[model samples]
Target chain A: MLEEVVSGGGSLIIIDDINCCGRSLLKCFLAAAAHKGDSIHILNFDIPKDELRAGMDSEVAERLVFHDGFMDPLNWNGEAVLPASPFTLKELRVCIGADASPVTLVLDSLSWILLHNPVSAVCHTFQHFQRQAKSTGLNVRQIIGLLHGDLHKPAVVDSVCCLASTVVTVTQAPSSEAQGTAVVLQRRKSRKIVRATEYFTILEHFALKSLGQHQPLMKLAGEKEETPAAETDPAANLTFNLRLSEEERRAKERVLLPYHLSAEVKSSLLQSHAGVAKIYYEPDAADDVDEEDPDDDLDV
Target chain B: MFAAGGSMASSSFRRKVGGGLAVIPGTRASVHNGQLLVSTGASSLDSVIGGGLAVGTLLLIEEDKYNMYSNLLLKYFIAEGVVSGHDLFVASAEEDPSSILQELPAPLLDDFHKNNLDKEEKTTGDLQKSMKIAWRYQNLPKLEVTPAARSRFGHHYDLSKAMSSEMLQAVRCHTFFLPTECGSAICCSMGHAYTLLLQSIHRVIQQEGFDGSCPQKKHKNILRIVLQSLGSVLWGDDICCSDHPQYIHSLTRFLHALRGLLRMSLSACVISLPAHLIQNKAILSRVRNLSDTVVGLESFIGSARETNALYKDYHGLFHVYQCPRLNSLLCDVSGTKDLAFKLQRKQFTIEIVIHVELQGVLRNCLHLPPDLSDRASRSSKQDLSECSKVLNAGCAAMTAGRTHLDF
Candidate 1:
């Protein structure tokens, strides 16, 4: 599902919080997009381009056109540093070009742009770029973004999520190469929302392998608790006696409720025939009964 | 716990780079992976950080309180640069770069052997002192000790003596004293001290031909950058002044830019940061994340751990917080975590605690139960020193040219 949403992309917002990084997960999408043969234009502000391309394949890496917002983002180093494009929509489309069908614009991070530009403006630019490209004869299909969720206000993250067609939240999961658990939420063409979560490992070639759906932790705990405590008694830890001593359990049988029928009565009651039922009544001391019929005097 | 995490398959590996390795001064190719590596001045630290700091990477030193040992480490780095004939770029906010340069510990130019190491002692006394230190490792197989102790890349510096003026004069040194570079007035704009510092480092890398992008006709030499106590009030950065400074990510951004510049250059840097003083750990974590390698020093000064019996032999503890994963999926983690560093008269060394070492040795000898060995490892440093003394006695007896049985 993560792969499907990644490849069938419109605008993807990867929300990563503290303790789990989202870059590797973003790489999984980049790899997926590249596998689909979409030219990826990255607006990199977070990390350097080489560090960006560190684990990626040379062939796929070649397909990534980088506009550097990191190296000299503020023109802080001026022309002495490498020529870099500032974060802008015009530069983005100009790089994507009019002829390239299905070009994917990847924001190495939208949070960096959010910090610089107004929250509304950044989201508006991304949303407008999608619609503006269609009318301009541009085949731009996806605008995938990496957002560090913890860095921004909840309102900012909410706004970013509101605009994105797909939001994949990457969090730490150790079973996989510590890659993380991805909870992908997508809005489909039918106007229905779809959400699925799976523990995923981004395998060597940036291949995504789902470790199946995430089992609710409470259910797993419940399963542990539900297993018979016969092997290791749950009563073992109590300071007070809560166990059945064989002798005491037998003694417990001797002491019964007042309403509990005697063994003979219980046996006789159970033995009654199915069709022609027999009343095997055993009277208690409190019972009152009249043997002679009052109607006998009236009959005479 | 490398988590290699259990060895990646051959098919998973990308094609290896094609070339002969370039020989850089004070550097060697890592045996684990074939990336170029340079020393951070402490060889044991280099080993703990998986061979050495790969060139074009940043090594951040989280300074201990009072900034004594981290400062020494920075000096050790400069001294090694001087010895190796590599160029130096030293930056400090609190002190003059030249004054800091003068105080660098002198390098002990002798061979790895203990010969001529104890110059003041008589030959007989030297023999006994050497025997005592040598016998400490006698229980372990000699093979496990020698090769690691004898790495040839970096030099050891004697903390007692300062480098001669003549030696300091010979090396090319660049200075970035913040007080002189940026006046006493703190910048109201974006971190000007930080910007100036970055700009200076950038200028040095570019003009000095450390930048790989611009090929230089001149011969290449590694520039060893020593940044002292950044984020302190003197650096005109306020990350330390208030809990929520106006610019929370100022120092981190500088480090990030520095790292970005480092990746494309032929230089490696060692920065000493007063991380203990940072009020917010999240900001500190961001700083740690920005740097490629981070090692923290916890000096046993006023801390309660100083009075603890377990750490008697060592002066302080050393932590390998993070090591860069170079060219491999997994990081090169050290075999053991119970590591401590000792600053002896001769040099500084980081090693596994003596108790842990004895646990392995005692397990081999007596085949002790797990609990017994645990108790033995927890025994005070005095007991282990006594054990080493007995081994020294045995070694002394064997040295007397008499028939003796060796373990």
Candidate 2:
């Protein structure tokens, strides 16, 4: 997913399932941005700032700037929660400050912001940030937003998906641990639409490492019947040896016709036989002899 | 044919521009920048689609049962760009495109380095010489020549060595992550997503100055746009319950507009949709109409017939459901019929199967000197007398090799 984001210049990415998707996606983006020597700013609206900071790998830690709004929600005299209105959003943007180099903005959770403000208001503010991020002169390369799908209505989710350039959804595994979590990453850029799925394991610090491949599990029962154990048994397997027995070999070597005769017959057949063609039928000599000798036979 | 195109390009006197669109040399209708064609990355795929996908065309790859095989092709497409230094615009809805690109298997050539050191120790090294047959096959008599008017983009890829770090570094990628959260401002509407994607791509193309007008720009680049997962339920569509038709309609509109956008710029697009997930033929056909090439892959996972002995030799069936008429002119349609795809450890081959009767083939070839070539040995025949029998036997053996089920 980070590759998709990095390939597309100045994109706004939304990861819908925060917990299921894991913070590793965030770390991945940060690592990529760092690889490109781009500055990184992550708004912490879900996890505590200290833990998020502690989990950061050294590779991308120095490049990252965390906005600890979740730990310390903006409040007016400790009484009212500051809504994620344009005013607060503006304040957040200003607090991050401007850099000459490109920066990647990571919004930890859009659901947290949507909780405080209505969908339309939040969307409008989002458009503002996205435009700023995508602006030609701005150092903002891309903006990544994380949201929880279950918390909002389908229409609202649809709107959010539409607003972003790429959408990745993480479906959590059930508590039984029998199945790994499924992550579907989709990108719609111009006419090209691509989707990929991976099963991932949750590690320490909300990290996700994908399982090697995403092949569907085979149904054992169905496969068992197709190649039953009894049929596959070693005793049941047949082996054929083409080696001929001594008697058969002798029989094959025995000439049915002499080589000279065979050659003469072959040559003769090749040359047309013009004289033997006139007789369509002839009376058998035995039939004529029987008719002539009927009176002399011992018929009495 | 390429020499002719080169000559035409050099003369410039015969150059024709069709309504501001660069008329690709020697082609009647394939209008694009400089007549350059891009590889679909997999040679098997390239052959299936006639020539490599023509510039400015869209390829729709629909997945069957599971997305494993189709996604592999997608990986090939992206990895090809990385290797060829094409600018990539990847908008992924599921996994980070970066991670996918990172995990892509290095092309077979990467192993050439490792194998080179031990070359002297192996007696089987000579086999590599025979392996170049596919590469040499191009020099064969033009059995089914795609006409000169049809620009051939026959850049065959050795999938094994196609991906490398140097090529990846050369690639300029514009990657956007679409938000999937319900009710998030970013995930608001399908139309907005399509619009935002188009705008981003337009910005990418214009920035590169490869929008076909800037011939002065020494670096000619093909903008490759890849979108992953068109109709996954996570794309904010309740595809199962209701609103399915609305989602399909929106997707069609997006693709239609995208196809229109490809014309002005030197670009091509590849999109993969999970047909099993969509579960609607009408919508898929509608999707099909928007693409120039349509390739569908069906693996043996769900069907009971997959277990049959006949299919045991095949990994899957690849249907060239549609090919651009331009490509059809280049390749024999019969050559692509009854195509089965078999994936080896390093590569995949798409070929027609000819099933010969198991009996008599070995005996005939071994006993007789084999067909007309045996005329030299026929003079020394042990039997000169049995002319008719010898003639009949010789005739029977001569016709033996011709019998087979071609389909």
Candidate 3:
């Protein structure tokens, strides 16, 4: 999603939960965004106040917009047991809409809000935000929801998927095993059209990075080729005209050379049968002897 | 001398018979004073003090379950000194001397009785048997045992006479019970008592020198100087938190004096501080700074928090390498290893993986948005969520492949 947005020539990026690997993500995003003259805006929920200022470079910090208060959900009145804040939904929509630049808006998590608020409210608010972003022609909008084995709760998740153009599921694989994590990206409610699964490994922290670049995207070996019926075979349609590039035709000929046949003269075969006359004369003598023997046996 | 040599040979024989090896004293040797021998009960503690506490050093034994063990060791030291004609002065800050004397193990009591019997040969079997019977009955009331024995012992036993006899001969032993609540106010009084004891000891040493020969007149003068407990007068309704600072300062100064001016050989000072007092960061910080050795006794109430904070502070100071439950910050051992094990064992309800890098990033980001200061201008929920998402993604990506990306 990030790559798609950057490739699409999007500029400013507002990404949340970047703190987790935000610094590294910012580095990568900046590297990519720098090419397109795009500025990255990172908002981290978890970074301590003092360090947020001291640790980040002044240049990056200028573009960075952080919201630290989100750490204490009580500040959002999330502790009220019900979603009471009238401004919450509006604020969410406004935040989604505020990116005037060609930007990708990344929401790090929807899990906290879903857990705190009614599922319907979260879904309604998220859907509204999604529609607003879509209408605004925002270059790219990426919302990463951390689903910690709670994808089974389909109410909010289903709503999220419905509103999202693309749903990427990032999971951590068991470290002791040979297999690493598989990041599956599927278009919303359309499994057939677009389903891409990429393998990723978790390194030192919970930062997920791609596997080796050299690994093949597809593996197809030990497959049996289906034999074509004679009438349906392309090779059988010799009379049909087909256009091919010179390079392609040369490649085709190289593939088809092994099945050609050779024809010898029929006269050679007729000359080989001339020494069989004695066998033909013995057949008439055997017939006369059989008739005489049968008459003599009958008289006795 | 005879007893010391016999014990030494017996110990050597036991070691040889047990392990079939000649024991080598590694980096330590025992010191002897004429016919007297003193050994610290624990080798680890003994190694630090260069042959244990000096003979005349005033030992403060805090009352607790461990007090019994410490007192028994003190008794052994006293017995050694007494036999060598060096006087032992015991000042109990808490327990009753009679009760403690009664609770003394039979072997120890028997040794005292034997010493008494050896001095006063005229005391026959009947009197000896009566004295034994009386000693048995003395602590029965204090003990959760028979009530009849308490009265019987109370009637027959002369505790003062017994104590005097124990302190008889060239070795004069004095025992005083000074019980004070281990609080800030009491700490001040204890500090004063400690100072006075040091000053007197200093005076005695100056006049008589460290040599084992102090004249009887000087010894009498020393014994006449009484150390009184101001606990009862200090315990009044007027006590206030305002007095705490003065007490803390005085206590710190007193400890400094003991450590510096007195220059007395201290084997150990078991300080029994009230849990609440130690929990006060100001008081504890001062105490920690002033004292090298602190034996903190925490009661059941607020024990967990107090113990944890104490361990943390002490661990920070590099005083303790390991505590039973608390992690030693000074040690290079990974605390995460313990956490991971606990997580694997299902010891806690929640497993929290603190992403330090993310935390650092969040700290950097928190200062943004002047609205964050004005609660009304707080960033929208969408903004916060986006921030959370970017942080998670970045963290995941970085952990996965050391990838650096701007969010």
DockQ values, each candidate:
0.00, 0.01, 0.00
Give the winner by TM-score. Answer: 2
Question: Which candidate do you rate higher for lDDT, 2 or 3?
Answer: 2
RMSD list, candidates in order: 36.0, 21.5, 42.7
Model 2 TM-score? 0.46
Give the per-residue lDDT of model 3 (tens digit) for A193-221.
23334444433322335543222223222
lDDT scores of the candidates, listed in order: 0.72, 0.58, 0.35
For model 3 chain B, the run of ten residues with the poorest summed lDDT = B338-347
Per-prediction TM-score: 0.45, 0.46, 0.24
Using DockQ, give the best candidate's number. 2
Could you give the DockQ of candidate 1?
Answer: 0.00
- Comparing 1 with 2 on lDDT, the higher-scoring candidate is 1
Off by over 4 Å in 3: A1-300, B1-86, B92-170, B174-195, B211-243, B261-279, B288-292, B296-407
Docking class of 2: incorrect
Rate residue B235 of model 2 by lDDT: 45
Cα lDDT for residue B266, candidate 2:
80
For model 3, the local distance difference test gives 0.35
